[model samples]
Target: MLVKSLNVLILIVLLPFFVKAQTCGITNIALGKPVTVSAEQQYHVGADAVDGNVSSGWFAPGDNNYIYVDLGQSYNICKIKIIWQTDGRGKDYKAQVSTDATNWTDIFSRTNNNASTDSFTVNGTGRYVRILIATRVNNWASIEMSELEIYNSLAGNTRPSVSMTLPANNASFFSGANIKLTALANDPNGSISKVEFYQGLEKLGEVLQAPYTFTWANVQAGTYSLRAKAYDNQNADSLSLPVTIIVNPSTRWSLLGNQGTNPDSVFLGTTDNKRLVFKTNNAERMTILSDGFVGIGTSTKPNAETKFAVNGAVYAKKLKITQTGWADYVFNDDYRLPALSEVEKYIKSHKHLPGVPTTAEVEKNGTDVGEIQALLLKKIEELTLYIIEQNKKIEEQQRKISELENKEVNRN
Candidate 1:
């Protein structure tokens, strides 16, 4: 009876260890490890199965295809998980382990697998783990797996650490700007193989060597979540904390200096329906309305009827005025030339010259310089015509007087 009781006590003492040996932790030892395959399709190489990304995987087309992973060294593998791609699962397969890779020993086998994902508690100790497929699900000729995770009951590889160094969190930039992304990555027990930069789920770029950097150019305007993922030489990877950034419209100009700017694309204006104001000495110097009217030396909105409004005088070396029509039409034959008597009557009654703006009109609505110049030219042309007519009359009178003199001399 004492022997029986001692045996029961001994079994209880080893119960916890046995339970621990049957289950494996979450760490996947097969990740980032070197892999080999009998045959692989494009973009579905054997390395994809251990890339730590379940979305990407390996695919081989034909019967009796197999893929194997090298864990770098042997481990006490306790769990094997296979996530099969839809419609591309292996119906008959075997999970095998090997020390020399040439001689393999099957730890688990399955026939007519209907599950898309399968996990098995395996008792194996080897440097390599392989999966051999004899037939595909639904009698398909291709076999594919999204992930093949091998968990070691013993200690395994450590994942690399990564952090973004450039473009600090919450940083802002202009659209179409070239942003340099940098990352600092290191492996605890191995060496870094590559660092990939991602904006959300989309990968921007990657660098294989040290001083990892990528230039993301011509990024559109939007809010983005950025991160860096570092993969070690063993294929184990870890992501840095996400960094959020803001990309504003490229129309914004810096008060400092700007480089690599296209003059045609640069603008100083408002994006919305608001007026843009310029100031000097804490006072408004210029204002531009949303409708394109400009004002100088004033704060109030410019006159809508006029394209430009100024409260102060303007100084320019030269000024130009464009007119749709000129007073040269005054010389047209169809134009009636008013008599001088009619012009005198108009000036006397209206207190201004004919076709000229009155003082009150000029003060209230302002004068158009082009219109005034045209009117003055028209008056000068009319005065020239009057002087020519008077000269002709005087010549006619002189001719008559000379004729009379000639007649008198002849008669005498």
Candidate 2:
């Protein structure tokens, strides 16, 4: 009998209130509306915008209060959405969270304004939460809020970390054997990331870059390739393609020139280079690499060490520089202006320049005599023929000298 009576009494109270107030355990926290507020309880932050206590006449004429909650433990927080309780529709709340309450980190904070979010992630672990009323969007009034929640997040997998881009790529080794590898691979699923080189088949010494390269001196002469694979915290690998490279066991880039008059910058121009800028190497070689004479420096001075490509192979020689940057001023002086003298002889023979009057010298001097234009055309032809003939004759003479010497030795 008593059980039946209690049941009936409980039903009467709950039923009438539901029909009257349309709320559960309803509390009159503000105005006629019912609010459920308890930091201990969990609820999804819903549509209630900064609905802090600002509108309830509870906030002093110019008062602001901050509210926040702590998740208690560190979590990989990717996203968070907040619901406000301010009567002006939550238009005056600034929200923030942190591992330490004293130090505040912004999740989303606005003063009398609305906030939006698609997604974002915090790097590490943290705790603490809060919302403060910075200003009144509707009125400079009170701010009050109720209800809070802590989101449970799915953690991200750590990417296989590279301790180093691994050696200066320019670093060389004599052999490819026992290449060291080192890396830090950890996963939520426990050990997913891996370190690899020469595709995936050749298992490296270790799994990472730390020990990736030990003593390249042991590697034999030839070319090789390298690469690394990163696994998500999930242990899935990204073992990549072979990044090609050359293993030059034999040293090639010699200390061509350095210091003193030879500022290493001289041997630089190539199709790969554009300008002549000075650069210094570890060997104290001040070097310049460029493409053409378009660079801002003087023309190249050739010598035995002055290597140049001829038909794709390097050619070096010791030769007398017939014409040089200072050729106009110096070529005719003490130096054997063999080339220039030849040119002068030809000009005298042709006796005229192209496109000029027949009596150009007289014409240029006083009246029309010869065309200088025609004379100049004659000048180039003479100069070219002279240089070609001279070089050929010299080469032929050298060969004959060598042959004669050999014959003399045989006779003796």
Estimate every model's Cα lDDT from 0 to 1: 0.87, 0.43
Candidate 1 regions exceeding 4 Å error are 1-178, 181-253, 257-275, 300-304
Residue pairs in steric clash, candidate 1?
32-234, 32-235
Q: How far is candidate 1 from the true structure (C-alpha RMSD, Å)?
A: 14.4
lDDT of 2 by residue, 1-412 (tens): 9999999999997885555321111111212222222221123221122234322222222335444445555554444444334443346555565676678776664553553221222333356545555554465343433333334344333344433254434455533334443333334433543454442355444343334443332455555665555555344465544445445443322365322222243343444644444534633222333533221222342333433322223346853334223213322335333466664676687874333345654544433113333345455555566677789999999999999999999999
TM-score of each: 0.41, 0.22
Residue-level lDDT tens digits of model 1 in 1-412: 9999999999999886665333355679999999999999998999999998889999999679999999999988889999999899999999999999999999999998999999989989999999999999887768888999998874356789999999999999887788889999999866898999999999998999999999998777789999999998667799999999898767656777555444567766668989889998998889888888888886565255787888988889999989967988878989899998999999889998888898898888788898888889999999988898889999999999999999999999
- Can you tell me which runs of candidate 2 are displaced by over 4 Å? 1-62, 111-124, 156-412
